[model samples]
Target: METIVPDSEGRGLLARLPGRVRDLVQLARLDRPIGAWLLFWPGAWAIALAGRAIARWDLILWFGLGAVAMRGAGCVYNDIVDRDLDRRVARTAARPLASGRLSLKMAWGWLLTLSLVGLIVLLQLERTAQIMALASIAPVAAYPFMKRITWWPQAWLGIVFSWAALVGWPAVTGTVSAPALWLYAGSILWVIGYDTIYALQDIEDDALAGVKSSARALGDHARGGVAGFYLGATLLWGIALWQVRPEPLALAGLLPMAAHLLWQVAGLRREDPADALARFRSNRFAGLLMFLACFVVGTAT
Candidate 1:
């Protein structure tokens, strides 16, 4: 069941740009920008949700920088860890590490550079937010190995990816509340649902590699599991809103987002990897819709 992703000749032609341009693309994962948005949106949403005034573009700008840098660092680390397995997988086999375009030393150097940029962004955050950001390092470091040892690396990914919620609340209000915790919980479930879809693209390769994932664990029922997770996410989000404003109307804003999740579940085609990737990337829109719901709920009520 080795899935061979045919090379997009168009992409290969585009890669023929100057070598420097190619290296930069590989370094920043420009070829895969979804990770950056996935990382940034929760933090941005949390900031908007906690704001006493309209969400400021300046805060979004800073979080954008942090997201790009941190996501680059995370990708570099993942490549380092998965280099061997990556070489065995068709979709990842042409990556910098797997293709031998980048040595370990060069990869480490790239990782450090990205991390320094992320550090600079961290310095701009409030003290509480800065500390919260620092607390994520260990979990981030450990995430690359979780798939080897557990059947639920998607859950670990949830924790790692949703950390911006913790930092965002502290950035806006200097401390987290019960409502904020609920938001964070909902964010984690949302990550799990989407990342599990993502993991499905690699399930056969992962199973052969002796790696475990929710996709492989859930097998043919993955759609049901994903739906359940999305439903739980919507429920937690509604509960968080209720905790903040305790009004039915306060939760109404989330219904559209809930419907969107339902659409994702109903539209998903489990056996199609391309369909899975599309559904997974579509979560960016889901994140935006939820962010708007939170912003309206927090700002108006």
Candidate 2:
């Protein structure tokens, strides 16, 4: 049997579990919660922006659970689809599917299990929210193939990952509105920016594997591209706040998030993979800052 190394991000936690159990946990990325955090924030932001953060705390809980489960399922599906490509990338070569620590059958079974958890959380949603959430299925299913056909696969990820904003706004307001649209739009750009940073880790291996990414496409201009994307996101989020409260102070809600994004861009070392991963992980805090802004602005009298 080949020795399997755990993903660096998850190694600490994974080291404490039994062999097979550890592999399963790693497969679901339970050991690394950053992806789930990113997936949950848009929904939380929408709920807060809909002025229901306190009234609909249950929805926040459900969305949080759903984010973890659904994100896990997405990772498993992506790993299964990109197993071959993963083997070609140094950063991803140790993933369960690519490393042969887990079989396709096991991966499929795990995906189904995680998806069932998502389904349970989906049942907690309103009919409109449920339908809106369901609508994301097609995009999510197609995401794994985007890198094969386009250099902007991150855009597709943005669409899929930011989908909770659509479901969340409807869940609270019972209808999708301009504010929700703006939040969703802004979130898409945010994802594109951060995922672009993430792709920096794989640029060389991706080139060798012929996998296209925004990071590779931007090349020497990646920092500028990230700056542009973050700027667009901040602007759209500002619009969302304005649409909701229409107060000058409402726009100030975005200042913290905007400043944080600026910090990420200003300090980003594009040539360093470790720096890229740290920057990518830092979006978890960025998400929290945005959520706090939404909560404060949405609840103001």
Clash count for candidate 1 is: 0
Candidate 1: what lDDT? 0.83
Residue-wise C-alpha lDDT for candidate 1, range 103-127, written one tens digit per residue: 7898898899999999999998889
lDDT of 2 by residue, 117-229 (tens): 99999999999999999999999999999999999999999999999999999998889999999999999999999999999888888899999999999999999999999
The lDDT for every candidate, in the order shown, is 0.83, 0.92
The residue pairs that clash in candidate 2, if any, are none
Q: What are the candidates' C-alpha RMSDs? A: 2.1, 2.9
